[model samples]
Target: MGHVFRTEQQALALDSLSRFLKAEVEPLYWHDYRDTFVPKEKLLPVTQQLAEFGLVSGVVSEEYGGLGADWLTNAMLFEEVAFTSCDLALLVLINSFGAYMLEKLASEALLERYLPGLVNGSRFVSIAISEPDVGSNVVEIKARARSTGENYVLSGEKTWISNGAYSDVLICTCRTSDEPRGGLTHFLLDRSEHPYEVQNIKKVALNSQSTAQVFLPEIVVPAHNMLGEKGEGLRNTLALFERSRVFVALCAVGIARRALHEAVHYAQERVQRGKKIAGHQLISAMLAEMATQVDAARLLCYRAAQMIEADLSAEMEAAMAKYFACEAAVKVTRQAVQIHGGNGVTTDFMVEKLAREALILPIPEGTSQIQQLIIGRALTGVNAL
Candidate 1:
């Protein structure tokens, strides 16, 4: 990583996004989840605003109403968005991610039909890859999509998916063949065409727009709906994951920054031993470590994002960024809680909530353990996962 977080103009743009989060998203998004569901009324307005923001537009071509920026710029944008609310950051992320994979690999016809809607935020889409039996192992997917004469019968259940409850379009990973690496295939299907069940997952310390389980039981889709060539599902998905993991790093960057901000503020005003806590040597040391670690995570994300922009495979770089950044976030947030003392676990303090949210970071995209496996392979030249 060049250690450059952003260009001057990009920094200004992100500053503007930070202001938008404080004014528009912070009040409602931070505390609004219905049981386990995020209300559409809250998500809709912000999503529509995001449509005009060009984060999602960066993935598509200028001919298709996108900014067409490099993947690194999009990753930076996600970092800023994550600072506002991790749940809200995911909305922008899903928008861009689903759009990116489709525009890159799906047919021209499919792009024409959905890019406008997706880019404009008229419709929501999500990538469906994880299943009950499968976590980081993409090849072990039990979801099957058999091609019939004119259509494919899709039957499977996907869990831990972003936007699973509300997305109208699902970029599904399905088993298309029995071949080793090429057995899986991608499909861009309209959920309206096939009635599927969705159950919102209840979780702890989660900052997600919406998380749900999608049940695809004997659903049918047209032959044209298949994304890319048959038997390339895992390949396409891994390619996307290499980039997506960088965004996961940025997500940690945003979250860790917020935790640092809250802790610094609280420390300055908190009195202990007849003095401000921040004046204490130990408290200042903790703050210094947090700032340094957050910067390191951001730099790693930038390096991975740059690799992606250069059209590199970037599996090792992405895993390193994702693993280190997320683990750092958990550590940073926990320390932020320690700085808050007994109030750290209460609803009155943001650090308590932020700490809880940080707990969810090491699980999504790929667990910290999975990222270690990927990194271990690159270092030792041995496949670990």
Candidate 2:
């Protein structure tokens, strides 16, 4: 229960990553091309360079060819990535989470086949957990898997899957029985072997990241591909999500930080009434609020990360962090746009893109309303769902 939000070594790591982002990512942001999806040509090299820095699998265990860093370090790295581009950070997050789950739960044979490539960034993976009907109700997911001795046949559709269109592998959750939440099971699906279909989803925000709806028609997965024990998929996936929620919270902090920085720069240079706009009390108040919120959100995110690292049940903490951080990001980004005046609505200024991207943080992983329910359930011991 000790505080895990100390500066110490994490400060050094944050400084290093910040420097890397400034050098490698900031200059690449061009306002001319405001595409919804990141150009693959630009994404690949940056990801490969990040892989070289061991940022992709910083949380994976050393036994799985990773740095074996703790959650605090992992959060720091994720925040840095988010500062550069939320889209790129999201792509890395999807792949990292997939790899972490595989390493933690997959059989040795499965690990040997996928973990190294995944850690090295040679192979990317996506998780298919949200079905069209399931949405936030993990227990209501209708995807089914039938066992056939040596192989399991999976049939389901996953909507809004991150990195679905380009992932080399997929970790899909399906129901294997009718036993409430305990009936769910997870499968490691190799796209090369299973002929699945992926349809790209176009969205107004997070354009640089690929989202898709995946179709599985009798996809055959080997028995060894099963993650953890049968009927434990719901529990296992929830655990993974708890960790992921903290990471996403850090991303929210990063997004808000970047937007705040841009707004501050713009405020100082923009003039009105023959003076710098930043000199005005109203604009100065907005910037001050943005800075305070960013700091508070970052601290909350780090607290959740520290709890996870300390082997604590972080359900409430994760929900609080995710909720507060994302909500704060939305507020700060909107204020950033307002501070920029007329330039805020135009694509020429990066604040417009930042504002658009901020819209996705509250919805993904879990919605803000869902987080409230989670925290409510924890505090009152009532199953609101």
lDDT of 1 at 361: 85
* lDDT at 170, model 2: 90
Q: How accurate locally, in lDDT, is each candidate? A: 0.83, 0.85
Q: After superposition, how far is residue 176 of candidate 1 from its true place, in Å?
A: 1.3
lDDT of 1 by residue, 1-385 (tens): 1256568867886677778878887777665551245667667777777666656876777987888877777777777778878877776778788988888887889888888888877778888899999997778899999989899999989998888777888888899887858899888878777676778787785534677899998999888999888888887888888988888788888899889988999999999999999999999999999999998998888888888888877999999999999999999999999999999888877887777778888888989999999999999999878
For each of the candidates, give the backbone clash count.
0, 3
For each candidate, give its TM-score against the true structure. Answer: 0.95, 0.95
- Flag regions of model 1 displaced more than 4 Å: 1-5, 31-36
How many clashes (backbone atoms < 3 Å, residues ≥3 apart in a chain or on different chains) does model 1 have?
A: 0
Q: Give lDDT tens digits, candidate 2, residues 1-385.
A: 1233546777777777678777877666443235555566776677767775657668778877888888878887888889888877888898889988998899998999998887877788899999888888889888889999999999989999999877889999999999878999989888899877999898878766789999998888888889989999999989998999987888888889999989999998999999999999999999999998998898888889889999999999999999999999999999999999999999778888888888889998989999999999999999885
Name the 10 consecutive residues with the lowest summed lDDT in model 2.
Answer: 29-38
Say which candidate scores most in TM-score. 1
